[model samples]
Target: MAIGVAAGVSVGTVISPYAGAALADDAAGPSYLLVGGTGSSNIGVLRESGGRLIPVGQPVPTDTGTLSITVTPNGRFAYVAHTVSGTLQGFRVGDDGTLERLEGAHLAPGRPIVGAVVSPDGKWLFATVGSVTNDVQTYAIAPSGALTHVDSVTIPGATSGLSIPVVSPDGRFLFAPSFIGATMDSYAIGFDGRLTPTGSQVPTGDRPALPSVTPNGKFLYITNEGTDDVSGYRIAPDGALNPIGRFPTKAIPHGMAITPDGRYLYLPQTGGQSVNGFEIRDDGALVPVPGAEAPSAPGHLPGRVVLSPDAQRLYVIDTLTTTGTAKVFTYRVKPNGGLEATAELPVDTGVTFSDGATGVFASLGPA
Candidate 1:
């Protein structure tokens, strides 16, 4: 009975942090999934083992169509964003990594809350709202896992609306890119988890949709849908940006993920129906891996890429355009930066996938 789950919540096996760590130490714990999309329901839940994902139960309902989801650092909670209604939902992460919606967890940060990201310390959650309003809401996380609204910052220059707010791995800076402006706005996270605009925004390629920072906090990469390339930046010590270079990629690339080792970058090209792999050089140059592209069915456009904590395995979710249907694929990371799709056929996820990732799976007891 984790806090805020309300009475008679049937989600089974919520484990303690210590027990979860023990399961993770043994490498037997299964990973969990929280996907957001335009479906009959707003969100979906699933579990993963041996590089395959299957629904854990029925899809979890949300206030509207869903956008993206981010888990807290301790693997204890998850926060999901809605595509409409300007609301965000919170959940308790079961010990088995199952999600139990928390009562009174519906929060209206602003109208049309579109993007959400959890601080690496698990102490804060940030969300962007109202492209017209340019509002970014901040919430403090209590020990009981409740969210207390903190402060809101407005970006007057974000006329096109804000993309996702990506926190630096070391938790020092937050980057918010505007899709229409070709700009990446930055903020310095204060000691109290408040955000102050650092004003280090650099111009990206064009129509930058998704931006991801390296796990080492050294560089940032953004997908340019309009430019058909990926933009790279060298992160300054104080969280400023120095233009590294722009690397050509597949068309309409939407998702950007880096391996845990910080040595490789993976971009799922929406137009090509394949994933392009790159070896991350120290100078932030993306050198293509020989035969790094893994082609899939044409309609199955890849959305998200999640890496195993050890960086040995990668999971990709592919979804069709019109229907609420998707397929999840697993790939083995070869030592040479090549992605070898596991022999397993794509599993019919049976739901549109808008949001998901890989982190701490679950902490099971003495499995």
Candidate 2:
């Protein structure tokens, strides 16, 4: 059994990549949806066409326990962090949105990875590993989409449960939240892609799950699952987070997405089984968007919420459900910051409730 998962629940089939050459081109490409889940190796590759997701080809063979996937802003590369196998895999994104495994792009950390994300400049990849070890690894991204270990840092005072890290829009700051410590830790990113402690540890609500920064890079918000509220922070000149205020939400807000313009914020409440909308005030406070409560399908627990690159569509993936099924809920962004139901795409089945699920929109267009 994978670490932290209950007995008898499958994380996926153990698979390895075949030796392959890396692609050298870095041109803009088409958008694609990459989906991975808990119990099966249904690595979906879907392209967005005419307001719907069309399957590109057969499921891509990948390592088991692959719950998180992060793509570069240029859409030239994608990275997968395998929780079960304790390895990091990189792939060169083809022009047609297919994934080609890059030779020498795999790294075995020998511990479970919580998540991985690329810096906005695509120069560095940061991954969080181990529930108890609290280690963060940094890798440099080559032009051929290969990875080389650059640095590793252990979060200070983090006893356990180091959540995923989020980089600032400017790529100068990295913020990581610790559930057990109930604190949000900030780090300074050196030009060489190394991390240095910023000495800024801001207290957050109980069990803070994810941290999100607005596109303007002026404010940061974190979804506090244990407190059933959202914490707002102002990004100081030095990348320190200054508390704005704590705003109330429905219940158990796990994941969130902010619009490109930084005018609206949407959060998925797993306990409430619905998506809530809020207007981001000029001072970094959140005010509920009137009539923006969008409910999820019965028995479905929404996990990760992501917005299309253009900010016209919103997608939420179900982390757990009782119907032996999992799905991605798509919505049209209304003018008033509300969600208009568009379509639901069923992705997999027999998925037990996991704390996090991977759902990312890969922008394939030119940088």
RMSD of each: 5.5, 5.1
lDDT (CA) for every model shown?
0.70, 0.76
Query: How far does residue 96 in candidate 2 sit from its true spot (Å)?
Result: 2.5
Give TM per candidate: 0.87, 0.87
Put down candidate 2 lDDT per residue, 1-367, tens digits, no spaces. 2453311222232222211211223223457777766456445665654456656655666665775688888887888777777777777766666677777678776777777889999999999888664777899988888888898988878364656789999999999888777888888899999998885788999888878899999999999989999999999878888999999987799878999999999999988999989999999989998877889988888887778756788877777787754667778888889888875565552234434536677776453
Top TM-score: which candidate number? 2
Residue pairs of candidate 2 with colliding backbone atoms: 29-364
Candidate 1's residue-wise lDDT over 324-366, tens digit each? 4776777888988898878877665556645422112332223
